[model samples]
Target: MKMTRFLATGVSVALVLAIPNIVTAKPEVQGQVDFFGGDGVLRSAEFDARIDNSGAAEGRMIFIDPSAAAESDPDGPGEAVAGAQGLLIDADFDCLVVTNNRAVMSGVIVDSNTPERIGRRILVTVEDNGRGRRSPPRRLTWGIYPNQARNWTPTDGELGFDPGAGTSWLASDAEREDDVPVPSNRSEAVSCDSFPPGSHTLVDIGRDDGNIRVRP
Candidate 1:
């Protein structure tokens, strides 16, 4: 009887340990963005995704917007961004879907109130069409306005704005209004005329302000 009871206890412990792996073995889908594009017709696709109560927290839905380099990938069923590496998706949150001439990006909405959230999002959005017309001709140009140019490192939910860190440029507006889209990652190649005037990497792209670097 004693041996039998010990054996049962061991089996129960083993089963409990295996439960987590079994639950996660299956990709618990939370949500998905579906669209259909074929031939020359570009139809607007409807987005759909849902959460599985049985799945773990890590099983949240993910919509990776690949960079322009691999937008039209002809691989088996897989997640990808237009030309970027990948993007993580989160439900119960508002997001921004930007459509430029070269790429399409669906940026997760971020409240600028938090600092770690800045660079938390990746900068996977890349334009294959030569980054548009060289900032055009203007007495005062805002290098990569709205979208952060470079040198901006986002952590947690806040961003490090550095004007002199990359090829991007920045301008100060006493009466600036609007929200800036944050990227999950940034590119290495920067344009000298892309950043604003400063040496800080932490900046609020939504507002015209100075840049500051964070101490890790």
Candidate 2:
């Protein structure tokens, strides 16, 4: 009787241990590649990811390109040329589906030549690209421009483009409105077999080499 009871207890413990695996069947992680760049030059890049745990060896991959630019004036007595504008994907991962997580983001141009000047802007969206979830990729081109033209005068006057959102064209009857989005900052990774001369300087992340552009 004692042996039988011990065996029954062991079986119960084994079943309990297996319950987690049975309840949450190891999710098959699926990843893929999505192209994001310009006509000839690359602007930005991102990789999609999905996993089961914080350190799961298996996961999915999704990538994208998020790029933009800024304009500043010349130095001292001159206008400050706007720095680079766009999103810098440091690293992102939300613990829960739509809750707590770490978003490592740095959206600004870093003067590769002078690492001193950095542009600032709030752009980029975190979208769902896994399993059976489908939603708008989340466009953030709104509020990405100046409100009014910054008059570039010497005698203590604002001299620069207005700061507002999405101004393909300036406000009514506004002058000197040249808020064109240029792709100055290139990706830090690219394929050697596919890159050309005088393109962006490639930076190696992990086992992959990408392109990097100086935020002008």
* Winning candidate number (lDDT): 2
Top candidate (TM-score): 2
lDDT of 1 by residue, 51-92 (tens): 234531221113323221233333645744343333333322
Give the Cα lDDT of each candidate: 0.29, 0.30
Question: Compared to the true structure, candidate 1 yields what TM-score?
Answer: 0.19
Q: Give candidate 1's whole-model lDDT.
A: 0.29
